[model samples]
Target: MTAALDAIDRAIVVATQDGLPLVDRPYHEVARQVGISPDEVMNRMDRLLHEGAIRRIGVVPNHYALGYRFNGMTVWDVADEHIAEAGKRVGDLDFVSHCYHRPRHLPDWPYSLFAMIHAKEKAQADSLAERIACVLGDLSRGHLVLFSSRILKKTGLRL
Candidate 1:
């Protein structure tokens, strides 16, 4: 099913995604910039969320700034039948900020469930992954843990 988004809706999304205004009246500020009433901006935002155009709306804190400098991408070779269950379980963990299934790319590696874990240090991140593996069961075909040594860029969606 497709939901049509009018110009105003598009504008609201584009503007907000760039970074919502930081002020006492952020909605009003955004509305003024978009040439719409504050009510209109709010209505559009509600509609967007209801229609699933926007899954969620909130601030994205910088993990590094929060002293969570160690980040890692963990890959697990979960069975096809258990991928959904395992993914959901892993996604629910607080340490796992991102989790999803992706097609396997070989001959170097083959893993289905990909998850990103951030922690104060490498050992902590690795420990979290190990815990997740234990919870998901050790029957997985294989698993790989990769730590991030650098961050190239971190930004919101570009519309």
Candidate 2:
């Protein structure tokens, strides 16, 4: 496992989550705000990426405003042995924004894989989900398509 990050390292993560500046001296700007040397900022970011403290550093946009207004959480009950492969296949679709495997909660439900798909309208999103389900075939045990009504919060983690 990776070692825990120090306070400074954590700060760097919180600061850069949105994205690094698109300039020749981007680290310099980050260092100025975080009160560290540019080289130190670069080194710390490298360490964070290598140690898995951070995933990818990139920009996150509001898909809705960009015309992908319809967002749906498509859950699937896929076989345990094939869950990973099925999730990968669904994630490969152009409409899929995120996809992963989650444990099924019993009694009332049993979905194992969850994928987020975004499109211009509900029909398009639903069609995309159906196509993904068809691809999984027998491995797909059950599926639910839940359309998003609103976004409450979208922010980065605070250090």
Candidate 3:
């Protein structure tokens, strides 16, 4: 069920949706914009997290700017019984940025587990895929690394 957000909660969401201000005290800045006390801002944010109104409050870094140019989405055909454990193991790899399960399209597409790997070079990306393969081992029936040729604009959800 979706949490019912009050006026202050909505204001807080709008104030920080694009990203909190790059200040030493970001919550304080958010409070200032939302016309509330910093403590209340933090408390509401905490409550929002617990209530599932907000999924996460964290930085979304630009990998390209950070010299991680090679972006590959590695798809794995993992056994149904082992998907949960396989996802956890794949996500734990230091080089993997994101890992999750995707519904497979039989015959054409058998991949279910998808992991995003970033690297500074093409070879590094390949090496990262190898590491993921090592982790999956017998669980992975087959896998493919789809390298991104261009970047799509990214934006946070608006309130």
Candidate 4:
């Protein structure tokens, strides 16, 4: 079920959804745009979070600008019975940005778990993949890393 957002709540989301302004006081900036006090803005944001209107308020960094040029989606062929445990272990790693389970395709694709890893160099990415493999141990039937050739804009749902 979706959260019921009033006009003020909708305004707040619209004001900050693109991204909070890069100002000294982002909340104040949002308040100015939404015609509310800074405190009210913050209070409403807190309530919105509790209501599940927003998942999180955090940074979306440009990894390429940060010199993390190697982006790979590492796929693993894991047994169904052990997928939950294996996914948690892989997702807990510091280098893993994203991890989840996916359905396998018979005869061709056998990978069931996917993890995204980023590094400054190809060798570093390969080493990270090896580390993931070591973590998986015998549970990992096989694995492969598919590197991204280009970057894509990451955005959240529109208001």
Q: Which candidate wins on TM-score?
A: 3
Q: TM-score each candidate.
A: 0.83, 0.79, 0.94, 0.93
How far out, in Å, is residue 135 in model 3? 1.0
lDDT of each: 0.84, 0.84, 0.92, 0.94
- Which residue pairs overlap in candidate 2's backbone? none
lDDT, candidate 4, equals: 0.94
* TM-score of candidate 3 relative to the true fold: 0.94
Clashes of each: 0, 0, 0, 0
Residue-level lDDT of model 1, residues 25-117, one tens digit each, is 999998998899999899888878888887787877777889988888999998778888999888898878889999877776679899998
Candidate 1 global CA lDDT score: 0.84
Stretches of candidate 1 off by over 4 Å are: 1-5, 52-55, 154-159
Q: Using alpha carbons, what is the TM-score of model 1?
A: 0.83
Q: Give the lowest summed-lDDT range of ten residues in model 4.
A: 1-10
At residue 10, candidate 2 shows an lDDT of 71
Superposed Cα deviation of residue 41, candidate 2 (Å): 2.9
> What is the C-alpha lDDT profile of model 4 across 47-134, one tens digit per residue?
8887788888889888999999999999999999999999999999999999999999988999999999999999999999999999
Models sorted by TM-score, best on top: 3, 4, 1, 2
Better model by TM-score: candidate 2 vs candidate 3: 3
Candidate 3 C-alpha lDDT tens digits along 1-159 = 257999999999999888889999999999999999999999999999888888888878888889988999999999889999999999998878899998999999999999999999999999999999999899999999998889788786788
How accurate locally is residue 56 in candidate 1, as Cα lDDT from 0 to 100?
Answer: 81
